[model samples]
Target: MNEYKIEDLLFEELILMDQEASDYEDLITQIGELAFEKGYVDKEFSKAVIEREKLYPTGLPTNKVKVAIPHAMVRDNVKKSAIIISKLKKPVLFKEMGSSTDSFIPVDIVFLLAVNGSKDQLTILQKLVGMFSDDDAMVKLNDMKTASDTIGVLKEILSQ
Candidate 1:
């Protein structure tokens, strides 16, 4: 079996900018297609994530910047663990996480997750959230000049 480190969950092919999604659903679908193409997940992953977001949104209002960490049921069809990091040219509205009220937030960044199991999901999530919460990280993400720059920052974030 292949050893799955945090690094394993990240690929240069999976990172990109200018997602150009008008809404949350479109954003999720676009990332899902990429995830499928990269052999990280199946087709059902995107649909599941879209539906899941309706019930339990992952729109996190962080200190640095707002981001959505959307995911779906992965126990069955996940071929590999990977995160598809996408940047929105224009922010899209999404429901807030764990809110009793029907609160919505504008998410500038989206982290579409496809992990093999619960452990990997939680581990990467914790790390990703930690890095996303930093003002410096957010700044770097916004000012990234190239795909490799974003990939480099993601690698460093995962290392920490």
Candidate 2:
């Protein structure tokens, strides 16, 4: 398996707003626009993001370290890629994948995955899951309050 480095995949282009929005719709819209502005997405990318979220929820369950992975097809957008990390002040409700019930996940970390396709996206996802699966790494990420701090922690994890 290819070891995906979150830092290499992330940069200032991936850092977005840190405040919480009223709802998922607004949150997704704001993040999608930022992705587009950074050349990671296209004009219609917002619609795709919403549609993808409706089909496959990206929220992951955790007690201390909550996160969400929102992603869509690159064909619907551009060839360039990015992974945005946002720290929200409040929790958001997202549907669980393969299930009808929704989960009120207190997601302080949001990883907006922008990839080319299933293969590359899956690779990135695997690395992300593997890296964050460690309780220590998750704690470090949760404690991070700034984009630079978060990126630094991710880089350290990638180096290991």
Candidate 3:
């Protein structure tokens, strides 16, 4: 796995807290565009992420909050191994991970990953999954008031 510091992958400009979107696609596209402008991903990154989400849903129904991890594996499009943390203003419908298409959940947060390496993707995903499974952590994340504050807490949790 590629060794990376959590802080390095996180950008203040990429963090979206209390954002409103019509749906998952809109949400992903909005964030993707921001990342692309910042040189973190290519132009096709958002479309690819939407297509990937359609085939393999990434939503997780945790104890306190429901979250989604949306990403694509187009290595060339990923300029850097970065993460966009978006806390939606209202919940959006998302098909649950590993579940049937009809099995949908309302996702309050979206973790949009743009990782260039497969190993790095899996490593960051594992850390995120562990964090999501923790009820206290989920609640804290859901209640976080500021993006920078949330980033600090995430760095502390995911750095391990």
Candidate 4:
């Protein structure tokens, strides 16, 4: 596996307050704005995010934990990027990607992913999946309350 730097693999701009009125559109706008501020995406990044969300819902079914993986296509707006993990106090409902059923997935942890390429993106996602799969890592991640704390945990995990 290709090793990534802590700064390169994680986005700190994920720290935000999303209200109950905030839908997927609002979430995408917030993430897109952060991506733009970080110079990882263009001004039109929100459009790409919405398009990607429409096609592939990034809601993962977590039996043991509460997490969501929200990603988008990298062709238009993304340059260099990482996963922006946000811990929400309340669960948000998202439709499952490629599924027709009315099943809505409730998620507390959101991983807003911005990638430069399709193949490279999957690799990053796999790394995160592996990291989160570790019982110890999940515990450490969930225990974190602040952005700095979360970033510290992510840095430690990536370094390992």
Query: What TM-score, computed on C-alpha atoms, does each candidate reach?
Result: 0.91, 0.87, 0.95, 0.82
lDDT of 1 by residue, 1-160 (tens): 1357777776888886877887899888888888888888888889989988988899998776789999885456578877888877888888999998989989888888887778778887888888877888787776776778888877776677
Range of the 10 consecutive residues with the lowest summed lDDT in candidate 4: 12-21
lDDT of 1: 0.81
RMSD of 1: 1.9
lDDT: which candidate is best? 3
Candidate 2 TM-score to native: 0.87
| Best-matching candidate per TM-score | 3
Model 4 lDDT tens row, 10-51:
655665433242666676677778778878778887787778
Sort the predicted structures by TM-score, highest score first: 3, 1, 2, 4
Give the lowest summed-lDDT range of ten residues in model 1.
1-10
Taken over the whole model, the C-alpha lDDT of each candidate is 0.81, 0.73, 0.87, 0.70
Mark the regions of model 2 whose C-alpha exceeds 4 Å error after superposition.
1-5
Instruction: Give the lowest summed-lDDT range of ten residues in model 2.
Output: 1-10
Better of 2 and 3 by TM-score: 3
RMSD of each: 1.9, 2.3, 1.3, 2.6
Per-prediction tally of clashes:
0, 0, 0, 0
Predicted structure 1, TM vs. truth: 0.91
- The sequence of per-residue lDDT tens digits that candidate 3 reaches over residues 29-133 is 998999999999999999999999999999888878999999995767898779998998899888899996578889998999999888878878888899899
Where does the lowest 10-residue lDDT sum fall in candidate 3? 1-10
